[model samples]
Target: MSSQPVPCKNLHEWLSFLEGLHTSEIDLGLDRVLTVFRDMNIGKIAGCVILVAGTNGKGTTIAAMEALLQSAGKSTGCYLSPHIHFFNERVRIDGRNMSDETWVEAFERVESHRGQVSLTYFEFTTLAALFIIARQMPDFALLEVGLGGRLDAVNIVEPDVSVITSVGLDHQDWLGEDRESIGFEKAGIMRPGGVCVYGEVNPTKSILQQASAQNVDLRVFGRDFGVLDADSEPATETMTDSPVFLAQNSAQQPIPDAPVPVSYQMADGDFVRTVLSEQSIPVSNRLCAIQALALTGVRLDKIDIDHCLSLISVPGRFEVDKNNPKYIYDVAHNVHAAEYLSRLLQATRQRRRGKIVCLFSALKDKDSKGIVSLLDKTVDSWAGWPMQVDRALSLAQLTAVLGDNATNAECLPTLGEAVVRAENIACDRNDTIMVLGSFYAVAEVQSFLTNRANRSRGVDEKGIEV
Candidate 1:
């Protein structure tokens, strides 16, 4: 531990300093973080705290909840993990990224009171986010767990409500190798007598056991609250074809599309019709967010829900490049997400006569083989691009899994080259190019496209002309 005052004067310098504080990138546990939390005396940070955990849908569910709460005239503070572009994206105050000065101030406070308690990169940043949120004192504080809920740094805060979006087989090394074990880890956020809104149709035995042990009010999807199939119908609205990601202004915000209405049966057996932003969101996640917010007494009228959902956009999930409808990007690295993406591709293929080409890469720890195999039937071809990160899967590993399907797969040295190859393959064929795999892969492609768009607009990354 460094006894000298932190040598950082800015957010960038402090981020670098925090990265070296611990040898490992992830050290999941609450004791070390809790000590700092108490030392900092950040008690009662918000009027209501919601802890959300899951394998795939955590970010989407939390984003939905934040949007809904804010629509109801409640202040919201959100903390998300594994940001796409910048560290500032990890912490949002009132639907906007906090300034670099805000981050520097929060880090200084955490460093001063840390008192030799070494924290990992995630722990340090999480503390800084909580400190900032505490100072602002938002009405609703939404915390997304970085990993398994049981020992994650965010678990140090007691939550009024917990949300388990879906339990899947990601991060098996720490959480466990099976769905049952993974469900138990996710169930850690539940408190006795508190409400937990589960999003999936079927609940794993471990989750049920945990909730029963804690005597928690677990409202499950397809049971206590779910989509009212009789009244629910697909919306006929279509999004305007425009570039969703722009490098200029550093705000890749997607424009608001027409609201799609969804009907759901609430816990009281009463049906409510809610309008969500777009059809890209899975109905299950939207239902879970509404149910969780309902437990907190956030009753929103139809118009309010529409307004909020229209303004909400979770990037890197079913993000289509409007300039070329053929180019799509999604951060689907695991089996569950891949299956959903595959179904989407199959549906799109049915509507259009064209081939589906997937540009893919994944982390060494992810189930890349499973994802590729799951989408193999729906995707006519594959373009493998190794992410630039150390944990990214090597070209050989990606090819080894392609195995018998190697004839249909093409490997490239970099993401940019791989994308060029993909575009060439899909050129003039009316085929779709879907970018899938880990977050890093999607972020790289998004950056490439955004830069290309900025250049075409005669503006640099800062929106200044050359």
Candidate 2:
């Protein structure tokens, strides 16, 4: 719709322009992007940039990084993709969404540099994020690769420490069909002499091979460093009363029962075992973030890190919005994530007295069948809806993949309708409801629950008191 180097007055305008800039939604490679990156001349950012790549757990890892870094009083700029609600949430500095003016300026800078190369939406956004981060010069610029790492726009920047959160079968058309192929693509973020951390319990062979060939100091999760000990504390009165999301009150000490104390060893042979009371970030994800931070030469005191853990919050990852019915929302689309969600749901089911109600939707490109298959046994009843997106796997297609269990699955007209139907069928307020499949599904479910919660509080949809 527009030529390179065109000016945009606002963030919305820039986004609209970017959508039609390139012929296709995804064009993976670096030659054209590299040329434009050099034109932007963000060669030496004043701060350190940590590039994180993987199939799942990438968001969780970066979330912990941001919270921990900010807790230590370091200015941080983080770039994430496919936001749930707001676009500004994708780019944050000091844990706050960047203003519209800041994003517009960054987009203009990137537009000014592209000579004749046609950059995809993700590529264009990547450059803009880097430009903004460089201008601010935060203590650390955390970049989450939009897709498979090697040719992804963020890979153009050299990261002091690269982390592969976990690899799985996703984006098979571009990343290959198996874990080996996908791992190689993600490992492309690693640089020679740079440190790389593998957070997957069993990393792919290709990942290990590529990092070793690059002479990277590869830290393996099980061998190099593993979670030694971890135990969960009991819930508190505050949490018991609210039961949805408990914000960290600076004046209060963490409830002894809320802490999920975990022990792990780092590359320095130093053991780091601390309690993460906040369910916002899981124990495994916390370990990944801690290792990445440690690699950055940031000496963290056990007490300090533990204290900051209370402040960590990652939206849409097992986000509990209602305690009575145990309504939880998570963006777990792939098989690896499904396994994690299954375990989480299983544990949650054991603690409660009712069956689980799963409201789900997924993109056609994802392993929708595998994901549904993993959660099928754990879920008692399924309520699914059609996603109004380009790559949405139709209700019929999903049912076919779900196999014999298709008999039990009910498809609704829209995601919103599915949410209502799920809540109605969840037995009562004591039963559990899980909203999963994709970020789109979780986002919509969250809105539904939020609106309902407001109504219950006697507030109208317009935020007016009844």
Top candidate when judged by lDDT against the true structure: 1
lDDT of 1 by residue, 1-466 (tens): 2245888978889999998999899888899999888988899989999999988788988888888887677899999988988889998888999999999999998888888788999999999999999999999999999998999999999999999988889999999999999999999999988889888767899999989988999977766655433334443222222111111110112323454444444445455654555456666677778888877767654436655655656888888776778888899989888767776786668767788888888899988778887788888888887788999888888767766444488888778888888888887557899898988988888888888888999999877998
Score every model by TM-score. Answer: 0.88, 0.87
Q: List per-prediction Cα lDDT, in the order shown.
A: 0.80, 0.76
Off by over 4 Å in 2: 1-8, 229-269, 272-280, 322-325, 448-466
Model 2 worst lDDT window (10 residues): 236-245
- What would the per-residue lDDT of candidate 2 be over residues 414-456, giving only the tens digit for each residue? 7777877877888576788888888888887776767887889
Task: Please report how far candidate 2 places residue 43 from its true position, in Å.
Answer: 2.7
Give, for candidate 1, the lowest lDDT window spanning 10 residues.
Answer: 243-252
